[model samples]
Target: MIVEHRIYTTHPGQVHEYLALYEAEGLAIQKRILGRMVGYYRSEIGGLNQVIHLWAYADLAERDQRRAALLADEGFRHYVRKITPLLAGQESRILVPAPFFTPTWQD
Candidate 1:
């Protein structure tokens, strides 16, 4: 499996606005298309105003297809428009687990 980890650094003091938007709108659209959410988190210490979320995919191909669908969704597009200005930076990484340690959760 592959894990996509996305970290969004919001404009200072805007984390709450981003979280509220995601919770009210983005989360449902994402859950409908990007089904394998590992977790969602917000930074409280070192990386203040950062939001981190993880999604697991069987492979890169599946990730691409699902992400494409998400991008096509009207609700997602609208949510993106509203949240774009609140972000300071965005980073994403695709992770491959080592043989000795793999995630136990099943999608």
Candidate 2:
């Protein structure tokens, strides 16, 4: 499996807005396109000013397809436009899961 992590840095004084927007708007759109959200977080320590979220994908191909579909979605486009003014910086990474990791809780 693949894990995609995105770390977003919000503009000063905009952290709450960023988090609120994600909760009220972004999460649902993301759930529709991305499937398997591992977590979403706001830093309380060294990564202050950051918002991190993770999603799992079957493979690179699937990830690419889903990302493309998400980018093409009109709602996502509107969402992006809505959040553009609040962003400071962004970073993303794709990681391979270790063999011990499993999608199901029983694993």
Candidate 3:
């Protein structure tokens, strides 16, 4: 499996607004299309106005297809429009588990 670590840094003081918007309008559409969401978090120390979201996919192909489907969704596009202004920076990392370690989701 592959894990995607998506980090979004919000313009100062906009983190709550961003998180609230995601919870109220973006979560469902994204979760439905993207599949497994390992976790969602807000940074309190190193980076103050940042949100980190973790997602798991079976492989690169699955990730690409799902992301493409998500991009095509009008609702998600609208949400993106809403959130874009609040973001200052963004980063994405694909994680491959080590040889001796693997992660799985029971559900």
How do the predictions measure up, each by TM-score? 0.95, 0.91, 0.96
Candidate 2 local lDDT, 1-107, one digit each (tens): 88899999998778899989878887899999988788888888896788998888888998899999999999889889988889989999998867887767221
Better of 2 and 3 by TM-score: 3
For 1-107, candidate 3 gives per-residue lDDT tens digits of 88999999999999999999999999999899999999999999997899999999989999999999999999999999999999999999999888887665824
In model 3, which residue pairs have backbone atoms overlapping below 3 Å?
none
- Report how far off residue 11 is in candidate 2 (Å): 1.0
Cα displacement (angstroms), candidate 2, residue 41, comes to 0.5
| lDDT for model 1 | 0.94
Report the lDDT tens digits of candidate 1 across residue range 10-105: 999999999999999999899999998999999998979999999999999999999999999998999999999999999999999898876778
Error of 1 at 52 (Å): 0.2
Model 3 poorest 10 in a row by lDDT = 98-107
lDDT of each: 0.94, 0.86, 0.94
**Residue 78 error for model 3, in Å?**
0.7
Q: In model 1, which runs have C-alpha deviations exceeding 4 angstroms?
A: none
Once fitted onto the true fold, the runs of candidate 3 whose alpha carbons sit more than 4 angstroms away are none
* Residue pairs that clash (backbone atoms under 3 angstroms), model 1: none
> How many clashes in each structure?
0, 0, 0
| C-alpha RMSD between model 2 and the true structure | 1.9
